[model samples]
Target: MAEDMNVSKGKLQRDLGLLDAVGIGVGAVIGAGIFVVTGVAAGVAGPAFLIGLLIAGFAATCNGLSLPN
Candidate 1:
């Protein structure tokens, strides 16, 4: 694989380690969910709003994990 590359091109470097990568991905998902769903969930469910988010996340995750590869 190394031999297939053009040696004249600059090498690419990884700036994020595994922890940073996972944190970034999780942060984006949580941030988007908070922005998109927080107000509506609050108005609808009041103090128990988080249960809806948790249930939806659980269902989505289960569905995702059960899909055929």
Candidate 2:
């Protein structure tokens, strides 16, 4: 597979192990999305995204606290 050029620099800077390499790649994509997707997310999810995120976070916390990790 071809290396993702976007992740190469971060992986190099982090002295990435295999797991870190995977994390670097996901981080690179997520960072780009945050930079590029504001307009799209706002248009699609509208003013409710913040509230939705909070609700989801609360649900996640409740589930985590209740469950065996």
Candidate 3:
């Protein structure tokens, strides 16, 4: 799946230390969003795809490390 990405997949699963269960969650997330959302964003937003990815990635980064209550 990650291999199919046009960009390099930098061992995010390994770094995340998620066992099979949560890894599946992450894959499901990326797969769903990357599949459905990317085309829409690219079409409507066009040249902002890269910039949008940067912003979305930053948001995702913050979300990832956030502590649970």
Candidate 4:
């Protein structure tokens, strides 16, 4: 058991750099904002919120496709 634990610990590495950490933080904030906005939109729009969500998703898809490589 002790040898197995030592091997597991040695195999793990702290590999995240500054940019990776920043990207993760930004992604988390944006994800939280999306959840809050969805809740508020649902309360205000009721059943219509689903329709708006579909439209938003379609728009996002289009926007993503239009981005230059």
Candidate 5:
């Protein structure tokens, strides 16, 4: 039954280390900062900022998709 299911019997490895954990935490903080800054920017710039934001998002999506997997 296990063979039919094709499940791996090998044990999973613990890969993440201290630096990886710290990097993840820093990324989360920066992500939150971006949101806060974006809100402030929208308030200051009004409707124009939203159009720029949409354009920036599309560019970012294109950049992300271009990266090698």
Candidate 6:
């Protein structure tokens, strides 16, 4: 005798819109770049660290977009 097991398997909803997804990606790249590049940027560019951060972020975004997946 098999008792009824109400196992619900539903598709997870996609709640994030395009802008929200893009913003999250950009924020993640910038956030990670801060820690990873701060020392290098400070050593190389001194007061131009902010520009380094921007370039790093842009490069990260481009890299992310170019993936085959």
- Which numbered prediction scores highest in lDDT against the true structure? 5
Which parts of model 5 are misplaced by more than 4 Å? Answer: 1-16, 65-69
Q: After superposition, how far is residue 38 of candidate 3 from its true place, in Å?
A: 1.2
Model 1 C-alpha lDDT per residue in residues 1-69, reported as the tens digit of each score: 645754435676447899999999999999999887878868888878888778989999999889686
What lDDT does candidate 5 reach at residue 41?
99
Better of 1 and 6 by TM-score: 1
> Which pairs of residues clash in candidate 5, taking residues 3 or more apart in a chain or in different chains?
none
Task: Assess every candidate by TM-score.
Answer: 0.41, 0.43, 0.42, 0.62, 0.60, 0.37
- The whole-model lDDT of each prediction reads 0.82, 0.78, 0.81, 0.88, 0.90, 0.79
Better of 3 and 4 by lDDT: 4
Candidate 4 minimal-lDDT segment of 10 residues: 5-14
Candidate 2 local lDDT, residue 31: 96
1-69, model 3: which lDDT tens digit per residue? 766654466654434454867989989999999778878878898888889799889999999999999
Q: What ranking emerges by TM-score with the best candidate at the front? A: 4, 5, 2, 3, 1, 6
Q: lDDT of candidate 1 vs native?
A: 0.82
**Candidate 4, 1-69: lDDT as tens digits:** 647555554466457999999999999999999999989989999999999889989999999889687
After superposition, the stretches of candidate 3 with alpha carbons farther than 4 Å from their true spots are 1-34
Q: Give lDDT tens digits, candidate 2, residues 1-69.
A: 126544554355446599988999999999998867866876799889778778879999998889565
Question: Roughly what TM-score does model 2 have, to 2 decimal places?
Answer: 0.43
Mark the 10 consecutive residues where model 2 has the least summed lDDT. 1-10
List model 5 lDDT by residue over 1-69, tens digit each.
556656566744467999999999999999999999999999999999989999999999999889686
lDDT of 6 by residue, 1-69 (tens): 122444345544457899999999999999999787777768888878878778989999999889685
Q: Select the stronger candidate by TM-score from 4 and 6.
A: 4
lDDT value, residue 33 of candidate 6: 90
lDDT of 5 at 7: 59
